[model samples]
Target: MANIKNPIIPGMAPDPSIIRVDKDYYIATSTFHWNPAVQIFHSTDLANWKLISYALTKGEVNLRGTNTPAGIWAPHLSYDKQSGKFWLAYSHMQNMAGREFNSDSFAMWSDNIQGPWSDPIYLTSIGFDPAVFHDENGKHYVSILEWETRTGYQAPGHIVIAEIDLEKGGIIGNWHRVTTGFTTRGCAEAPQVYKHNGYYYLMIASGGTGYAHGIEMGRSKNIFGPYEANPSGEPIITSSPHHLFSLGDPDSGHFEMYNPKSVMQKAGHGSLVHTTTNEWYIAHLMARPLPNTKLNPLGRETSLQKMTWTKDGWLQMIDGSNLAKMEVPGLRNSDATIQSDQLNNIDDDFNNSRYDLRFMTPYREQKSSWVNTTEHPGNLRIYGGNSFFSQVNPAIMATRATSLNYTAQTSVSFKPDHYSETAGLGLYYDSNNWIYARLCQSDKEDGTVLRLLQAKLGDRIDYIFDEVRVPNNFAEIKINYNLGTTQIMYKISENDDWKQLGDQLDVSYLSDEGVNGEPGEVGGFTAMFNFIGSVDAHQHDSFADFDYYKVINK
Candidate 1:
């Protein structure tokens, strides 16, 4: 009977972590600084999702200069069914510079959910979203958030629970803190635990992701708890519930705000699944913001609601209400075939071995000498390493302009001719903002030239086109972005027709949710990238032949 109105999984998917296995369903998200991080999806009828595979592709962790929401937070995803394995739990948020929140928590396991996975296993410096549960009797728990920088306690955050051994990485007992939620909302973090029937529940994520997020719950017979809340004490799911007290600050008793009226804004982290026919759902994490203008550009997405259970067993929402929507009934549509084009085709002729799950690379480790398929078989040879503001290293490989009216074309045949080679085509949003459209050579005018630089935030480098000679061998470069009205166009192809070398760029501040409050604020957490870079400081072996790289989405 499908038709709750669609939107089973749309853009920017955030902290969701579902799992089913018999009827097949899987989901995992959260990629803070965006590398190869964690983003996996696959569904049967939870309403179509597809994009399977990506659980971090080794760099082993070191998100070079991470910031703007800090690299990789929340990420769970379980499945034990008695050692059929599949676990994953994360948090690598290395320092938020003065926001302090240092972070480390890790764990990984796989028997197969499409993974070779199994290197990370640090598990716990504790202070970032981490969840893992196994107990039916086999035992293997982990639920974190001990982070509390001290001071009269209460709101520093606390909700521990331990008992894991996984071949001696440690954690045998004594950690239990349990209930620290429900004051109004402090910073209760992604916790998750379940048992059902006899009850054990748990499921947290309280205010403070912005606008007082929520999704609380508690219950206990034993698993280590006194737990109770949920007599409608509030937050069964939210999106502004009067703003939840506003979420965390009553001298830190928590639940700071309480303003639920709904239009979807910072809904709450969540996960819980059942459906094979048993029915039940809650995927959570929502945020639309833009109508009145809060500007959230698809970030924090992944929604679902539809729940039941309460003969007094508790667990509402099936229309009982707490916000969270986009349809949720018995659910069983998705037979596949909903392609009006799901938008994602930045065009590349690299000839796959895998590297177009919408490319992304920053903060180190993804080197085959910048890129290579044995040099040039189908074309994708980007060598000229180091230099993007070098946080450690940079060769760059982006993708994600998804839409705002688009048109990014590329075709280069560079020979930058020395003086630190440089191959072009970029739009990036980090390392302090970006915008490039290069194809250098001019060393006092002899040939090859076509520039239009700008680096902002990271500082110095603003050329805006100086040597425009067009047809310099195998040229072709286009940018075009409209984004409603930020207007930017830069074409170059001359005689074959494309002229218009530069001067239209208003760049509406390169949004995704950027350009709001600047001055050491830097584009609010990123979401604008479209690159193909190379910057060798005169090590020069120079090779750039990208016969194709399209993206057209008006």
Candidate 2:
């Protein structure tokens, strides 16, 4: 089974949401404020995948100060062959300010997709990608995205669809706008619903998510809709297949709809799946920039496409070309065998106390108080929080810089007696961009140096004459990065040779169009991260340990 390439799950794993439930497929992505939020992946070979679970681990939701693409956005995973259970639908976007994009869509369930889940059920705050469609006789709709603050109408709204009564948790009536986009590339949000053959189709995600992202469709035998579009009104999947008039644009950063011959760029938020050998795949959400640079520091990933169905049922892209393809053609005769560390390079060595569910942590909730591998059973302590320009407790742990060229080492032992403590290894992209190199506490004479700290767009530099002295706070901190440049190295033994702690630093602003939001928007859809952080702010008793994080992949 080879030929299944294009990110079958790579890096930040954006809007995805696939599902299968029989030969086991499961996808579900978008964890906008990190943490054990949404994510969930597992495959039986639609090209090997496996991050297992996290349907919002338990606190169920509350991404602290959440703002930077605003926490937990699209996570719809459905499965209910007549209440066999497993639904999930999400969105807790909580305010995007003057855009009034405030959100709160929920819905949860689980008879186990690897969950204990079953708490949220709220269902609508009016806008923000929510999906949930399980119609057949057990009826239950719930498409969403009605967010349009009428300045002229149709800027980013209207996909609506209701009739959800999950045993009486709300919405069994009004809300049915349906279709503000069938292409001319409007900012139509994620809709998703399907019924096939007798038609009830309706899939969306158009134009906005940068560079004219797409994946659009429509049909109807009346699931509520006049739904008919898609006779090549364009976009059945896209990496900018030309012709874009942008209907009321402003979902942010159309960047002139960049498609320099496509290396897979913003290929739309999709999620379709059929395969049990009847085959049909779509798992979308792509972005790869950083060469001639439109700069996407590995955020928004997860691709796969190979659809087909058109005798008059319409759902193209199986070489019919709506563009977007890095190689797709597996699972039709399936031999299944492609998981040699699925996409390699994340060598973690925290030695069994466990710490690699692809370690995420950003705006809080990794809890063990402040992260712990059972109090350093082998290493990976991390106590010190706040200060990485606090988005409330930045005790970073990060992971997901999935290659634009990688290197990322780690070795911190950290001992900062003050100067507000610090620990090392960096990259991150929130709390206003980042670079960080840190080791701290030299304020001119009390030892342990290594400094670098930067944060663009929200300002804060502090290289402090590029300090370097590290004689024993234990050093190893690396970073290579490449593509948009970044060098920052160090060494203190284990054969020593790294030493380059300065120059070469462009970091392409850590990128999601390089941070800075809310005043004309476009910054952070959650991407680049390498992390290993710490920061005491004076006696949280400091803590960093860490002895092994390695990321290799060049």
Candidate 3:
């Protein structure tokens, strides 16, 4: 039997959309502000998952000043059996100011799950978290929340369905307001429809995107007709036990439903699939706040729960309950045979033919000019480009912080002749939030200096330690984050002897849940990334050779 473990997939993987083809299962996740968006994973067994490739790589959308948790929202993945093409639907939340939420939804198709995906085709302007359902009659239908900003409406933000004509780039028929998700606890979004056993089942995410989040279901005989809620009169899967409504409140469209008994805050936005062994599972997003604290560093990760059909023709957990977790039979090997803590290492030597899929750049395209693999055989040479704050571009490639307690170390040899060129290792949450131990040339003393700097979310330049004369040209930097606290250390050799450079920076604010503001208000969408970066603001050519980048879990 399979049991619920700690974290199925860790580190900023949210809004999981899973699909199974033959015996193979693939999962796609949302990457809000992170560039090279839409992470895809492959799995043989339900327990083990590995990074396959990213869906978006052409810089299809600009995300320079995209606010926290406001870039790319929920992404839906579906495979068309007729064309054998993988269709992906996502929402680019361009702006969320005044909580206006003017987002545009788009679609992309690829022959294979990995390769060169086509450019995005505009789908609808209808709210975020859009899903596509291809019917048996070769017709495609889309279901999404029609965000309500108008007055005189009974229930704002209702789940609407429309037939889509893929070639014409528009809807063919009228929009049907099927359900407002009122009976099963209001505030619905991320609607996915499926036809099974002569019935149409519509699953939606309801109860807001917070502690009271849930997966509500309704079924009907016709595709667009009167649907009946689950006979349980509650959510099929939810961490919250609160009776909330999204009906009367004006901003009820975006109201936060509170649930006092939630073990995992924000446990909704789910995708369903049947395994090779004919067992059903629901992959949903779940958040875990630090032990007794509300700081969630791993963000929303993918979690699975066994589900079965009820005698009343409704889907329910194996155990007749509203919560999502219970021990169930495994589809592959037994639960004891699966490893609980299996994680791919983050060590990189740049010896492969292509860059690691984990590495991602900020805003612009990845230029071969900044990084040269041909020149340095086993190393990566990163030339400084622009400061982190510049809207133009920045020379930085980073991977997500996989573990809360981990150490990232990198060796870089660079001669900083000007104040603009600097190379170092740091923890980067965003362009605004970062802390680096860098080696740069000081203009005042006319010599190379080692400095420790901290940049908050809105601040420009905030130096923690001024230019301190150390070995000027070549040095190694190590940043160790203890989850609760963070330390900056430096050394010049490969030995374990490291010297503490600056004060312990409390980085508890870097977690997704700890950052201030409401659900969609502020804070980064993903966790912080560990990176080796260089910035050249002087318009001069400077080379920084990084020997290796290694991350050790502590």
lDDT of candidate model 2 versus the reference: 0.84
lDDT of 1 by residue, 141-216 (tens): 8888777766666554778888888656668877888877854666788888888987888888886555567788
**Model 3: per-residue Cα lDDT at residue 98:** 62
lDDT of 2 at 28: 87
Q: How far is candidate 2 from the true structure (C-alpha RMSD, Å)?
A: 20.2
Clashes of 3: 0
Worst 10 residues of 3 by lDDT: 248-257
- Residue-by-residue lDDT tens digits, candidate 3, 1-554: 65545346767788899998887888899987677888899887777788889888887888776666677888999988888889899999877766567899988889888968888888888788888888888999888888876766643478899999765667877889998883546667889998878888999887665566789898889878688888767788877655665553323212244334554666778999987777788888877656556666667777877788876788887777776552334575555344343364578887865667788776655667787666787778888878876534777878877666888888888888787788888877666667778888876747777787666654655463545565647777888888557887887656647877767888776666545433444355476778888888887488788888888775
- Candidate 2's TM-score: 0.37
Better of 2 and 3 by lDDT: 2
Q: Any residue pairs clashing in model 3, and if so which?
A: none
Measured with C-alpha atoms, the lDDT of residue 101 in candidate 2 is: 73
- Local error of candidate 1 at residue 455 (angstroms): 20
Q: Write the per-residue lDDT of candidate 2 for residues 1-554, one digit (tens) a residue.
A: 56787787777999988989888998989888788898898888878787877888887777878878888889999998987999898888877889887888888898999989888989879888888888887889888878888788768877989888886678987988878888788888889989987889889988888878888989999988889899889998888888988898757568888889878888988989998888788999898888887878887889899899978889898888889887888886678654432375888778877788888888788888888888878788988888888887789989888778878898888878888888888888788788889888898657888889888887988888888887878888788888879888888666888889768788787888888766556777788888888989876877888878989876
TM-score of each: 0.35, 0.37, 0.91
| Candidate 2 pairs with clashing backbones | none
Error of 3 at 510 (Å): 1.1
lDDT of 2 at 404: 83
